[model samples]
Target: MATSTAAARREEARLAYDAFLEECPTGQLLARISDKWVGLIVSALGQAEDRSLRYSDLGRKIPGVSQKMLTQTLRSLERDGLVTRTVTPTVPVRVDYRLTDLGSSLGGLLSSVKLWAESHFDEVSAHRDTFDRATATS
Candidate 1:
């Protein structure tokens, strides 16, 4: 009876997890972080000891990012409350972005994901190449 109850509870948990995934898909998160520029920006910001970066400096730090795309990504991150934007009063307005507490928590998660990708990317590529070769031969 105890074993049966435990099994039923496990089945209920699995169903809840599946329902949650269906309700809130990972596609949006993937769209936010999968972009080369976004990942670079997030990683760079995450690395900063202060966890903050000037708008102009950030643009220079991440090479190959267009002004438009960076602006868009920053706006999206700010809207999501993952990053905070501050405008400083100066001769010319100075703007900065810093990761919020929530965003800081995600840094470790992103780092792990990055490490996994680096470690396994070559193996995955090799597997794809082998599959392609086999298909060609067949």
Candidate 2:
């Protein structure tokens, strides 16, 4: 009885996930993953041979990222179980961030997207300029 009830609940929850829906929970996830800082942070950590980086190292690697934004981004990643935050006990204490298995899976896909964007920057900029000029005339 209890087993069947739990299964039913699980099925119901699964049915509720729909990324195309305006109010779906997955929409929030999309927004989180699509954030600029999130992409940069994930890319930085993902490219590491060890897939780990300290907070300070991440700050240095990603330019223009505010301390508060980094803190927030890391917290969100940790909360979503995408990254693992480890702390070491020491005189000053040490903290490190690394990709979990799930994060690692996303790393390759996001890395590809980053590469594509970098490779196409000039072409995209020209298109944007053309669009802007055409729109300005209208």
**lDDT against the true structure, each candidate:** 0.80, 0.92
lDDT of 2 by residue, 1-138 (tens): 345688888887776787777878998988999899999999999998788999999999999999999999999999999899999998788999999998888778888899999999999999999999999999
Candidate 2 overall lDDT versus native: 0.92
Worst 10 residues of 2 by lDDT: 1-10
Clashing pairs in 1: none
**Model 2 lDDT at residue 93:** 88
Q: What TM-score quantifies how close candidate 1 is to the native fold?
A: 0.69
Highest lDDT scorer: 2
As for model 1, its CA RMSD to the true structure in angstroms is: 5.5
Measured by TM-score, the strongest candidate is 2
